[model samples]
Every structure is written in C-alpha cells, then in structure tokens.
Target: MGYINIDFTAGCTNNKWENLLHTHSIIQLVNTPTRITSTSSTIIDHVYTNHPENIVETVVPKIAFSDRYAKCITRKINQKDMPCLCHKQIRYRCFKNFDENNFLGDLNKTSFTQIEQIIDVQSATAMWYQLFLSVINNHAPIKMKRIKHVRQPDWLTDEVKEAQKKEKCLPKQRELE
Candidate 1:
C-alpha cells in the first residue's frame, strides 16, 4: 500500500500530535508557510506521508473556497501522451444588439406566397416552415464559442475574497505547544 495523507480542517496548533505520529514513523509533508486564520496563526490542516521520497513538493495555494488553505501535492510520475480535444458551444444572439423594429421589418419582407401556391399540403407546410426558419436564422444567427472551465465555487462572493485576502496576510507564527 502507498502512503496516505489527511487534512484536518479544525485549527491544530499543538506539535505534540505530530511527535506522536512521527513516533509511529509517520512523516508530515505540509512544508508551506504557517496556516493563517482570521484571529491567529495555526496549522489546522496537515499532510502525512509514509514514503516521503515520493513527495516532490507541497504547497498551500492563496486561492481557496474555505478557511482552510488548499493543499497541493506534487509527485514524480511517468508521462504519457494525452489527447487534446476542443470543446465548443453554440451561443445564440442576445437582444442586446438586436433592434426590434429592424427585426420586424425583416420579417415583413419575407415572401410566403410560394407556400400557398404549392399543390401538395406537405410541400406547402414544409415551404412555410423553411421560410420561417430562414427569416429567424438571418436575424439571430447562432455562433460557435469555446469555453474554458475554471475551478471556482459558485457561491464565492467579494466578501469571501476579502476574507481570504485578510487571512493570507496573517504573519508566520511559531510552532504552538
């Protein structure tokens, strides 16, 4: 079995727990700066590894969704070829640049007289539908747009950002007893 790592969200300032873990040959790999809180500096989260050599680096990113800073683990692994795929989506025209009067005028200019002249009912219905579609497509054309996905919480607001900034500014503190 490989080494396992755990993160404790609750503020843990005591070094005694680490000593106990080390006594059992468990090594803690969270080597970043001191954990910051709104009130004080503490190491709430921890990363433990049985095979320390496998861990290349550990970092606590500034951006996070909660009070606990995100812990990132870097390890050496064999590289393999990966396929690059493009993800595209259709973006329909919005009313922002659409002029109602111009759209109505365009619709008025559409000729549907040929639909009534068709002898077959199916042909007339198809012609009428095609005319309607052509008018709409000319007015509100759909466009292909590519989107990049970002890892961010939907509920993250400006207030939460401010708080994260404040916590990040907290000074590095000495190991707690």
Candidate 2:
C-alpha cells in the first residue's frame, strides 16, 4: 500500500482506518515506523493483506531512495498452485566416501566376456552400460535430496544487512546534526 499520510498508531483517524480495514477483513502488516526523524518517528506507509496467514515474513528495508522505508512481504507458496516455486527433488550419486582402490579392484574383477560375446551392437552397448552402472552404484550409491529455492538477491549478505542497520540511523543522525 502507498502512503495514506495518516498515522495509524494514534487518535481518531487511526481508529476509523483500523475499523474500516477490520470490517473488510484486511489487516495492516507493518508494525514499525516507516519514517523517522531526530524529533519524531511515524508509520505513514502501510501494507494491507486479506490472507494474513499466507504471509511468511514482512520486512521494511531502509533504502536511501525515499524517506519512507520500503515495505515487503513474502508469502508461503502452495506447490499445487505454484509448481515453479516448489522445492526440487533430485537423484545423484554421492562420492564422498568412495574408495578409489576398492573401485579399481572391483572394476578389474568384473567380467567383460558377456559384452564381448553379444553379436548385436546395441545389445553389447547396453550390456557394457549396465556393467559400468553396477560398478558405479556399488562404489557410490544414488542418493535423493530436496533443494529449496530461495529468492534473495545475490548481493545480500551478513555484511550488507549490518551495513543497512547502520544506514537506517544516518537520517536521524543527520537531522540531529
């Protein structure tokens, strides 16, 4: 939601606005002050959502583009509704505990006679693939893992978050000066 310029935290204006929103089943998500000065801090900016339970998190990042901090909300995605947002399940062979010597010994002991005896080229190729797969499976078995995809910006880090906390105080510091 955009700036209503009415402080929703105090007075009759706040009560009327809150009553109207509540009647319509809309809830204000932001609780922190959106704008701050050395003398005062007020919540002028707002975000209203009907499905409050769907909201996972809300943030007010103090960006320098405006006096008011940016309001953002992350909603929980339903896998059936948003297939693209669902976590991916992948199958892979993990080689973390694979022993090279054991693998080599197994490889050396394996018989290639069945593949050699096969007359058809396709059959021989299939047999060779199966034998190779068996050796690989014995050495490093296939594993299944679920990977959750996050949408955070690549540049966002612990250092950047700490810097933003420091940056938020700069405006008030300037006003005081």
Candidate 3:
C-alpha cells in the first residue's frame, strides 16, 4: 500500500493540513522556495510521500503555461512485486424479478412452532433470519450476471466526429488563448 500526498490548495497556514505533516511520517518533496506563489509568497502546492527513501527526487517545472506549479516525483520500486493484481468481479441479482406471491407462499411453509418456543432474544433473531433466508432462496434465488461490453456505433458521420473533436479540444484551446 503506497501513500502519496498531493495538496493543490493553500494549505501552508491551514492548521488541519499542517497537523497531518506532524502526525504522519510523510516527507516533503517540493524544496524550491520559488515554488510558492509570487504575490503571496506562500508555499501552497505540495507533494509528500511516506517512502521518501524510495523516491529519487522531486522537480517543479517552469510555469510557462499554467499558474499552478505541478510537482513531478520519481520513485524506485522493487520490480518483483510490481505485477498488477486482478480480482474476479462478482455479480449478484438486484432482486428486480422478485415474485411477491411466491415469496409469501414459501414463507407460509416455514414452521412457526420453533420460533414460538425460543426464549432467548438472540436465538429468536437467528431463527427468524435463517427462516427468512430459506424462504427467499426457494422463492427468489440470486442469479450471477455476466458483464457485456457494447462497442461504439460505426454509423457516426465525419461531421459528427469533427464536432466531437472540436468539443474535446475546446477546453485546452481556451486555456492556451
């Protein structure tokens, strides 16, 4: 579990954020004093890492295109444990096809004599839960669903593609201008 701290807002004087630096063993990476705001001269933007020894160094690029200074961190990790982990996706029924009449019939078949004879509160609760699950399993059994990915439509015209391209590029174009 690797932890990274990226603070973009003005957090230098904020007591809540400053407390984290003291409580946790995180090391600050951005060192240059000029990385702070020019007008306020406050070190707001920061990047911290728990594994400071693993990191080679941090660099603040020249603010040529944007006001915020982006910090770049380089870390060396053990390659033996670098393989990505994949977990099997689990899918369960959302109970959209639950039959009320079938569920009522199954619940009616449950023996009530055992529950009536229960003296302890915990035992009664457990018996009720077990009976409920048994009824539900018989009437509305859960089904595993398989995921299906839908491909994009190939009927899109050249004009629509051009419009979509323009829409994506509009933000960057506005920022540059």
Candidate 4:
C-alpha cells in the first residue's frame, strides 16, 4: 500500500476539543470513571467510530493538580519479588482536559479517584489527579483542633482548687477496691 495520511486530533493547528455528553454521563462527579461499583460494562464499553482504525498507539501525557505532583504516589515495588498488581486491573474512563496526549500539572484531579470501588493510587496517571485520591499514611493530616489554656482568677482561686480536689477524690474512689 502507498503512504496514507490521517486527520488525527494532533494535526489540528489549534489545540481545542469538545467533551461529549456520553463520556460525561458515564463518569462520576468531575467526569471520572465510576466503574468500581458499576454493575454493567458502561465504564469500559469500547467507544468505536467509523474512522479508520489507527494501529499505532500513541503515548498519553500526564497532568498534576497539586503542587506535590511528583511525589503524589510513593508505591513500594520490587522486581525480584512479585509486588501488588492492584494498579494494573483498575481502569478508569475519565477524559483528559489537555490536548490529545495528556494534561500536565493537575495532579490527582481525574474522576477515577472518585470511584466507589477500591482504586489504586500507584498509577502514574493517578498521581497526576491527586485531588481525587484518598489520603493514605503518606499524607500528613493537618490538626483540626487547637489547644486552649485556662487562666485562674484571684477571687475564684480557692474554688478552682476545690474542684481539683474533688476530681482527685473521684479517681481515688475508683482505686479504693
């Protein structure tokens, strides 16, 4: 056969595209794949068109939302020993915001993280959509409460002391056995 050209999205001079309603409906909030609890194959129903099939599989780009994009997922894996293959089986049908390739610098914002089923956070793309990812041991939760110090008044100093004594007596009563 002779050389043939294809009008792929990448060929477009302006990087622009429209999100289809079908893709939007399948995903969960934020337009991510909602397959974990999906009773049907709606999540992975291969979308096919009459366009000529392109055997070539192009590489997809990555995007990060949070500033901690690089370290989004710190997965422990070893080649010698078989590591967890959970990430491999979890596939999401979220749409990419950037060009045909991938979005860059929107860490953990994909719909895949919002799935009801257990989704792996180790995938490279998952790191890019960190906003949807659940917090694990790797993340340090910010303390929600603050500590307060009680001040004593000169006139009520005796009352405060009496309360302390009563509290101490109650504890002693428990140990009195």
The prediction achieving the highest lDDT against the true structure is 2
| Model 4: lDDT to the true structure | 0.31
Model 3 TM-score relative to the real fold: 0.37
**Candidate 3 structure quality by residue, lDDT tens digits, 6-34:** 33334445567657876997656666432
Q: Tell me the whole-model lDDT of each prediction, alpha carbons only.
A: 0.62, 0.79, 0.62, 0.31
Task: Kindly list the per-residue Cα lDDT of model 4 for residues 1-177, writing each as its tens digit.
Answer: 111111122232212212342344421111112122324211211222222132222212233352211112123435667654433322223333323322322233345534345354333333333443333212333223322433435765778779656745654553552
Kindly indicate the candidate among 1 and 3 with the higher TM-score.
3
Which candidate do you rate higher for lDDT, 2 or 3?
A: 2
Lowest-sum lDDT 10-residue window in model 4: 27-36
For residues 74-162, what per-residue lDDT tens digits would candidate 1 score against the true structure?
97654454333455463544455667788888878989887777887755665676677577666676565665543346777889779
Clashes of 1: 0
TM-score: which is higher, 1 or 4? 1
Q: TM-score of predicted model 2?
A: 0.44
lDDT of 1: 0.62
Model 2, clash count? 0
Tens digit of lDDT per residue, candidate 2, span 1-177? 778777765542667877899899998888778887787678888888999999998888877476778888899988778657568886656999899999999998889887888887856765686687789899999898888864556787989879767745655654554
Supply the TM-score for candidate 1. 0.34
Runs in model 1 deviating more than 4 A are 1-16, 33-35, 78-177
Which is superior by lDDT, 1 or 2? 2
Candidate 1 C-alpha RMSD relative to the actual structure? 21.7
Best by TM-score: 2
Reference-based lDDT, residue 105, model 2: 96
**Which regions of candidate 4 fall more than 4 Å away from where they truly are?**
1-151
CA deviation > 4 Å runs, candidate 3: 1-54, 57-73, 76-85, 91-96, 143-177
